[model samples]
Target: MTPSNTHTRNTHLSKESEQSQINKAQARYRREASDAAAAFMQFWRKTKEESTVPTKYKELMQLAIVLVQHCRPCINLHTQICVQVGCTRAEILDAANIALAMGGGPVFEYIGYLMQALDEFDPPKEAT
Candidate 1:
């Protein structure tokens, strides 16, 4: 084959190799993220189980932390846990307020997510 043809073939192979490498990196990232999520869940469960604080209180504190961190998923999970553990709406609001105070203006944007979580997990009842 001519040199030009050889160069074209090599360029194609290089591009394919680059794509394969990118795919491998993406797969690795996904695997690591899944593993980290599993580990974190295990640690979270163990801590809640063993803590001297009540589960509801722990969930409340977690809500405050997630609010400050602006983690929507954590807010959803912990808000649901709070409701499951018998936390009142008042208690949830209080935790959110404390987080907002501590987190300042940035926290305001995420508080909407918190409210949406509350609505999703513990919607108000209609009057009889």
Candidate 2:
């Protein structure tokens, strides 16, 4: 099998490998990519926290979608937090759709990753 196929098949082979991917990503964010991520996040946080945007949560969520579409790592992190804080899934996704609506095909590809992050950070719970 090709390397891509091998990795895809191995992904289901064990939980360790799945976890390793997550760990690797987190480590990269904290190490090699931290400085840039930190600066980006700081600016994002300041904008959302200090600004008087009419609909801050909604606006931020939309911004997150656009940033994720643009592959901005730090914005993705804050976007996840915004979702947890109060932004609805629909609102977040609408933002993503806006990106596709304006940006066309290339921007659409990132929707899955954006949705995946949204799911990971804001998973649905069983109603009890």
Task: Count backbone overlaps in model 1.
Answer: 0
Winner by lDDT: 1
Candidate 1 C-alpha lDDT tens digits along 42-110: 886798983688787888999999999998667877888888878888889889999999999989999
Cα lDDT of model 2 by residue, 1-66, tens digit: 899878756743543465567668977887878888788879866665634564546555566556
Looking at candidate 1, what is the lDDT of residue 122? 81
The runs of at least 3 residues in candidate 1 whose Cα sits more than 4 Å from the true structure, single-residue gaps closed, are 1-39, 123-128
C-alpha lDDT score of every prediction, in listed order: 0.81, 0.62
Q: Assess candidate 2 and give its lDDT.
A: 0.62
User: Mind sharing the TM-score for model 1?
Assistant: 0.65
Worst 10 residues of 1 by lDDT: 119-128
Pick by TM-score: which candidate is best?
A: 1
